[model samples]
Target: MALLVEVHVPLTPTPGLPPGEYPFPWIEQVEDFLVDLEEEGAAESCDEGTTFGDYFVFFLVGATEAGLLAASSRVAALKGVPAGSFALVTDTEAPEMGTGRRVGLPL
Candidate 1:
């Protein structure tokens, strides 16, 4: 079964992302990364309830530990993304994206 990975990216300036303003570009990068994962048969990002308030919240479905780890590495390495940006890994699927564990990027 696949797990739900909720990636949280900051929209305001922070220690991780120096000038976290360009939320659009950052989000586009994230979407592109998810597409890459899907093309590689790694994961699939669901875009039903994505939000853009204080930060960005998106949903990705993949395997367990390894999948989350790989995704984390990619997100952390993103151009404007910060290694401090984190993701919430859940055993459940979308819609109910339940509370699971918190893992830092580049894990």
Candidate 2:
């Protein structure tokens, strides 16, 4: 199973630092939180990466139900991050197998 977790983080530019500094600390915090959940049998594997922008974005992939739950909990906890802002979303399974279609006109 594959689960995609999207995180949107708000960032404020520092006086001397570059605009949108690395969210390493926030990342570390998230990683640590996820690791703890994994240790508690709440996750299978967690792969995290970042995207650049005025707001930080994080993508996490998990391979199990526990993993998904862990990811969700971690994201929820980030609501209080002192950063500029934050948002999180998780992928859900389709109602039917291979029954969903993309809504768009094929060019």
Candidate 3:
């Protein structure tokens, strides 16, 4: 049962850095953080193969709240990342358990 975790990371442009300068340093930092999670047993694997618009999406599998917190803390320390960026974790195997309400009644 693998979980689909969406980590929304807020990015900031650094001064003196050109638009195409490419912030590889900060990106490497994010990768390291994800790798640590995998090594710590908090995550099964971290997939770095997705791109979300301008920002990259790191798919963190088998994540917990504690693990999320640790990752967020490390990411927050980076210069180009903001403080409020979050890691959204959800079980991919779990179905939507919400109650369905009809919008319109039948005549």
Top of the candidates by TM-score = 1
Q: Model 3 over residues 1-107: C-alpha lDDT tens digits?
A: 65455555545445567677775456666677667767877664454535455545555566564564455455556565544454555555546311122111000
| Candidates in order: C-alpha RMSD to true structure | 4.2, 9.3, 10.0
The residue ranges of model 3 lying beyond 4 angstroms of the native Cα positions read 18-20, 77-80, 93-107
Q: Itemize residue pairs with steric clashes in candidate 1.
A: none
TM-score of 3: 0.57
Sort by lDDT, best first.
Answer: 1, 3, 2
- TM-scores for all candidates: the values are 0.71, 0.46, 0.57
Backbone clash pairs for candidate 3 read none
Candidate 2: give the clashing pairs: 10-85
Q: Taking the tens digit of each residue's C-alpha lDDT, what string does model 2 give over 1-107? A: 45554445545433444667763455566566667766776553334545555555545454453455455556545634434433333443534221222111110
Candidate 1 Cα errors over 4 Å, as ranges: 13-23, 93-98
Which 10-residue window in model 3 sums to the lowest lDDT? 98-107
Worst 10 residues of 2 by lDDT: 98-107
Winner on TM-score between 1 and 3 is 1
Best candidate (score: lDDT): 1
Residues 1-107 of candidate 1 have per-residue lDDT tens digits of 56677777666443443464543566677777888888987777766536645556767776566776677668767886644566777755435543667777766
Identify the runs in model 2 with alpha carbons over 4 angstroms from their true place: 12-24, 63-70, 78-80, 83-107
Report the error of model 2 at residue 49, Å: 2.4
